[model samples]
Target: MKNSTCLLQPSLATTVALPVIYSFLFPAGSIGNILAAWIFSRQALTKRTQYIYLVNLVSANLLICSTMPFLTVYFARGYQWTYNSVPCGIVNYLGTLIMHVNMYVTIMILSSIALSQYATLKKNSDAQYSQAGNENCQRFLLKKFRQPKFAKYLCIIIWLTVLCVTVIAITRNARARTMEESPRCYNIRVEAGELGAMVLATGCFFLSFMMVLLSYYSLTRHLSEIQRNTCIEEKHLIYRTVKRNIFVIQMILTVCFLPYHIFRPIFYVMLTNNDCPRLNYLVEIKNFLTCLAAAKSSLDPVITLLLDKTFKKSLCGLFTRSTSEQHKRNPDIFIEESPDT
Candidate 1:
């Protein structure tokens, strides 16, 4: 076992950029999630089971957002904190725990949404093809994914599985690395199990990523065939909505998640080998990418707005009310004075 000191100091970018990035993420993510929660509150979950997944996604995002201020302070203070301090441990552990939960939970929920949307599209296609009202066996299995009870159970399973795995991994890793503590909170050493866990998580992420890609491709193909065969505007619109939802899910994974998972294994390798000089720079880069992943929480509300009709209605109504109030306060501004006649 290599008894490495905490040689991973923050670079100028890590110190400056992390705090700034997380400072922005905090308020943005908080407001977005709060709005999503409020909007979701008004709707019945049983009527729209996909909202179950979205609500869970928003919950995960909110959990991570709550940790942002502590993280921002930790990074801003040049990554310096007494290793044995209670506060330091709480911040470090919660930050790590919530971040991993957010990443993996987001991955699972979005994958579920994509798969559900694809299943819905296929159901529509089957009807269009006049399959004598016969349900394909595979479609029947996926159809369960769209049901309220199944979605609820699935969300519960996802939360429990992710939380248990993350907690176990963090605890074991911390126990293995706690000898001769470094004065920095983020200076964690990689153990063999941690590396294995990282690789496993990365593999899962890629698998989900590929699933989203396949769903998108399948949707596009179906949409094209439908457009060519029939000019039914309603079918076209339905296909478009499903396609856009899948596309947005793909974009979120690509922008927020791809970089971090891509770099994580390489970072673990470097950290384990103790390439002291280069490892410092790599840590900084890894942290920035991690921030990007966390920023997806801030982006989840936008996803909710796009994907949920009820949420969109609520948001639009809120905006309309705010505008009405503004106009009420100043009627002359809206009247425009007839453009000076």
Candidate 2:
């Protein structure tokens, strides 16, 4: 029964699902990420930090997406790995590296944004507290807290650390491949160096999660302190901002990514152990959730468009002008409604 179970693992099902997943994602994710990259690239210098992180995110997404075609073809060929050993090593290495980088960059960006919000709130709170003491004190504190220099340095350090780890993982994976006669191509031997590589990747994942959680906790704590002592209006605004930001971040991590991570280890264990039929259902669900998580990258631009007032206004104005032009060209067919009504 154990042998049967091992043999029955859903390798074929996974292969069959690959192209379908790729088809769904390529148009929506690949295209959307590219458009976002283009839009962010054109923004002014003041928009550099957020936009630069976004560009990195988009670039990583593109790199990941670019591999889908190769993957689709590989899987469509029945997971036979006909692309030769070098291409196989390169593809697997690049794909995994990009995936890790994307995950880390996203976490870093969110932490940076959260830290920015926290700093802003802290400065404002300090200024108000100072004003309560004396107007001159408030002005002096405001000048002193005009910028948070450490935030930029912190972001750069996070990026560099993640980049170094990703490069190391890719180099290790590439170096570890060996040809297998049955598979007809080079593959990482799970019992050998691949195990170490997997451990490193898992460590990186946990570290990223830990950093994000800590940053989130700190931000929340600072906000709570500010809220406790501030004026009613300022307190309300700060609370709302903090609540919204926390909700968005939590939704992104828990709703989108947590399920995949939670199930990944379980799936790995099931594959290593004799594959239980029950595990197959869990694996299917995990794959679906992973696809949903990947979709989040594609949906991020849309989320910004909906949530950001400035972006919403720009989109609305563009659409309104286009509609008005259409109405002018065909007055009898398209009638405008009066705002008074």
Cα lDDT tens digits, model 2, 1-341, are 11222222346556577567766766777877776665455444223333434455566567656656654554444235532455555555554346545665665565455444444554555646542335466344333322333434555676688778777766665554433332522122321124454465456556655655665675567566655766557356544655566456656766777776676666555555443565455545654665666666666667656444433443454557534344224321101111110
How large is the C-alpha RMSD of every model relative to the true structure?
Answer: 8.8, 9.5
Score residue 18 of candidate 2 by CA lDDT. Answer: 59
What TM-score do all the candidates reach, one by one? Answer: 0.85, 0.69
Candidate 2's clash total is 0
Candidate 1 has its poorest 10 consecutive residues by lDDT at 332-341
Task: Please give the lDDT score for candidate 2.
Answer: 0.52
- Cα-based lDDT at residue 308, candidate 2: 46
Computed on alpha carbons, the lDDT of every model, listed in order, comes to: 0.72, 0.52
Task: Output the number of the lDDT-best candidate.
Answer: 1
lDDT of 1 by residue, 91-205 (tens): 6667665677667888988898888778766765766665344557767676776676777889889888987887786777567546646565556542112566777789989
Q: What is the lDDT of residue 12 in candidate 1?
A: 70
